[model samples]
Target: PKTVLLLFASGKLVCTGAKSEEMVYESIVKIHGVLEDYDLLFKDE
Candidate 1:
């Protein structure tokens, strides 16, 4: 299943519909990596 991601201006990520906590965390890490590639990651909190 595909998860829904909500990225805010404050660099806060809201991931929904993940089957498990581990999946959510994994997705967040991937998303952060993508953002970092573009030099858009300001915080990881």
Candidate 2:
């Protein structure tokens, strides 16, 4: 399965994949983890 991750200033994520729902969830969690590690999750308004 393949996937792509997109991040927006609105603190939204867009994911496109051709796999199972579990995969989508895992991908989202992983992506968020990466972003958090880089301090890119989000900031106070």
TM-score for each candidate, following the candidate numbering: 0.74, 0.70
C-alpha RMSD of candidate 1: 2.9
Pairs with backbone N, CA or C atoms under 3 Å apart (clashes), candidate 1: none
Instruction: Encode model 1's per-residue lDDT on 1-45: one tens digit a residue.
Output: 367889988766789999999889888888778888999756465
Candidate 2 pairs with clashing backbones: none
The candidate 1 region of ten consecutive residues with least summed lDDT is 36-45
Model 1 stretches astray by more than 4 angstroms: 43-45
lDDT of 2 by residue, 1-45 (tens): 378977777777778873888888888888778878989755677
Best by TM-score: 1
Q: How close to the true structure is residue 42 of candidate 1, measured as C-alpha lDDT?
A: 64
